[model samples]
Target: MLISLMGYSMSINLILILKAILILVLGYFAVKIVSSILENGAKKSKIPELVSEFVIKLFSAILYVFVILLAVGVFGVETGPIILGLSASLGLILGFGLQDTLTNLTSGLWIAVMKPLDKDETVQIGGITGKIVEVGIMATKLLTPDNVVITIPNKLVWGSPITNYTRMDLRRVDVAVGVSYGENLDNALSKALELISEHPKVLKDPAPAVVVTGLGESSVDLQLRAWTKTGDYWGVKGDLTKGIYEKYGKEGIEIPFPQMDIHVHKY
Candidate 1:
């Protein structure tokens, strides 16, 4: 009878050990699979990379906790109360200590909901202009045209003025050009309009406009206004400036520069 009792006890101990091992091994792989599913779903749903990564990591962490609890149960240890106590303690501590962090997190959530600017879009916010690399949990990352990376806290971004250039299909380009006072205003206007119209990127629907906006101290200031695709705005504006410079040289239209007039006084 004693031998049979000892045999039963050994079998129970072995089963408990096996259960712990199985939970640990299976839980590890399970977390990986779930993380992969979440990644694919995020991609399919058009979620940003940073958001998807956060979700997957958070889910995996929660899953690991449960797996650990189950494994501890196999050893006859009660983990529920301990987990609750730790969670409460951590939450209280974090709530009291992480004011700015919490603000950033809340602001980030607000940004996600409002979506004033999206990933890969060009935007100017909080005195920074760049393409959005990621909208992270704590901050938004921007890649500048000069290849600089800027990480801005979500609170600042949410509170600041945001200018999203990519939000519209087209934008207007304005180039203020100046010609010598001796130049014919009508001829300069026609030539400026002609160059703007001939540019491949400039939109014809709005029609290019060349008007004398102001008379500067040195010359007659002509404003050349044109419409182009937002992506081509900078390129088209540069082209217009260069074309104006070349055309004026070819047609005897003098581009006036700042010069001081001096007169000699005889005493």
Candidate 2:
């Protein structure tokens, strides 16, 4: 009886206004709760944090709009047609305004899914060689060898070929050794093989090969093919080259240099 008397005392219009206000306040709080839950779910998915955060932010915005419409509808506002019309107009405007951004976003999605490259992997892409620091929805961050941070748009990165050096377990080092044409090819070949085998970093399983690749203007070019752990490739090449020079000088092997043999014609 008390509740009925209070309801009758409040004007019907005033009661509806109060109810609308209550719905709006509750909807605002609900939006926050739902946004928080969605953000938590995104984090749990274990994808890139930047991508997940972006996706969650977009989702929360749409949810907030839905909540606002629900609150408005409680006040006897016809929101369905308004919402549908506004959504189409807004979509068109946003699509045109954010065309470039959408391109990068789609490219980022492809990167996340295709995964041709990954974080912490050293790669050369789009003329930039560096270690991937972070892959975001708009751009990817890389730490270059010189310690400079480079941000490349995901669209450009996705369009280019990525060279991942660290992807392979082993790498082959090719060093060209030239000996005087007069030097015995057999002796030079043996010396090249010996130098490669003696190097601790060179993998003995491949059995370093020395072959006559070409004859240069002044020397017979010998190509030394050696396999080594990718990490040790440079070290092996440098150390073995030094060994070749020292060994050649000791064994009287000649490394030919540029010189022209002048033929004199006496008439």
Candidate 3:
């Protein structure tokens, strides 16, 4: 009788193990199918790629946790207690060890929803200027113009002021130039305006202008302001600066050097 009882118990245990394996296999396929569906739906719904990726990953993690618990239940484990214990442990960990990580994650979610910045957009945030590579759950990646990669925590990014340079359709270029105190003020201004106006990239709608900004100790300071398409901002600014110096040289405008005189008397 004892031998028969042991045999029956062994058979039941074997059946339970097989059931657990089957659940795991089905769970794997389910996760795959659900992930694919979510990805396609996000794309079809015109969701931002950043937010889409974050949502998919978050859902996948939760799905995996549930799948594991379901598999464990086949062996007569009580899932309710397990889930409660896991929740308690997660709360404890998040409250202490992962506090900063939790902050970044929440900040990342806010950024994803608000979209203060986007992938490939040039932005200045937290005193760093770069093109956004990716906005992850905990941090943001940036690729600087010099080919350096930077990672910033999302908390700082969300808290700081963001300057997106590429979002605007047009930009204004301001170039400062100085002239000798003795040069023809009106002539210098006219020449500077004409030079900028003739540039192919400068916009005609809001005509370019040169205005006297200040008088330095040795020279008069002027600023050349022009509007151009955003993409041509840097190029236009550089061209205008070089052109001004060359034009002034040919026009005999002397850009004076700073000088100071001292008088001495015998005591």
Candidate 4:
């Protein structure tokens, strides 16, 4: 009788093991089908690749967890206590060690959705200015003009103000020029406008202007304002500045230097 009972127990265990294997196999196929459907839908909706990839990975992780629980239960192991234990452990880790990591992950997801900055766009965030290289699951990568790659946590990026320089079609270049109080005002203004207008990169629709901003102690401070294509902003500004200095020299316009004449009397 004891031998028969032992044989019966062994048969039941074998059946359970086979069932567990089948469940895992079917789960794998289901995950693949769902993932493929998700990819197709993402393409149809024109979703950002980063956001779509993150969603697919998160969903797949959840599905795998469920599959694992189901397989474990088939072996006569109770799942309720296991789930509770795991939940407690996860809560403790998140509350202590993973708080910042969780914040970065969520922030990255939001950043990917909103797209405040895209790859290859110049941006200033949290005082770090660089072109975006990648928006990852937990961080954003930026490549600075100096050829430095910076990895910033998404939590800080999402929290700070984002200045996207390349998103707009046009950007205004402001050049501060100071002329001597002795120079001709009309001649200065006219020459500045003519120089900017003649530049190939400066846009003509809005028109360029040089305006007297203030009267300084030694000179008249003027602002040279012009609009150019976003990509041409820096180039135009640099060229215009150099052109102004050289033009002023040839045209006899005086760019002032600070000077003070001191009077001394013998006591």
Best by TM-score: 3
TM-score of 3: 0.85
Can you tell me which runs of candidate 2 are displaced by over 4 Å?
Answer: 1-90, 93-97, 259-267
lDDT, ranked from best to worst: 3, 4, 1, 2
Counted clashes in each candidate structure: 0, 0, 0, 0
Candidate 2 residue pairs that clash: none
* Candidate 3 residue pairs in backbone clash: none
The digit string of per-residue lDDT tens for model 1 on 1-267 reads 122331232233777888999999999999889889888888899775655665676678889988988886776555777688779987987789878888887788778777888899999997789999988778999999999999999999998999999989999999988999988889999998998899999998888899888889989999999999998989998999899899888989999899888999999
Which of 2 and 3 is the better model by TM-score? 3
Off by over 4 Å in 1: 1-25, 42-61, 64-77, 261-267
Each prediction's whole-model lDDT (CA): 0.86, 0.81, 0.90, 0.89
Off by over 4 Å in 4: 1-37, 48-50, 63-81, 259-267
Write down the TM-score for model 2.
Answer: 0.65
Q: Native-vs-model 2 lDDT?
A: 0.81
Candidate of highest lDDT: 3
Per-residue lDDT tens digits of candidate 2, residues 1-267? 122331233223666767777877887788789778877887788776555655766676777787777765654556867788798987897678878788888898888777777788788998899998988778888999999999999999999998987778898888887999899989999988988887778888777899999989889999888999988877888887788888889999999789778999999
TM-score for predicted model 1 compared with the true structure: 0.77
- CA lDDT of 112 in candidate 2? 79
lDDT tens readout by residue for model 4, 1-267 = 122331232234667878999999999999989999999999899889778977887899899999999987776567788899899999999999999999998998999888898889999999999999988878899999999999999999999999999999999999988889888899999999899999998988788888999999888998899999999999999998899999888999999887789999999
By TM-score, rank the candidates, best first: 3, 4, 1, 2
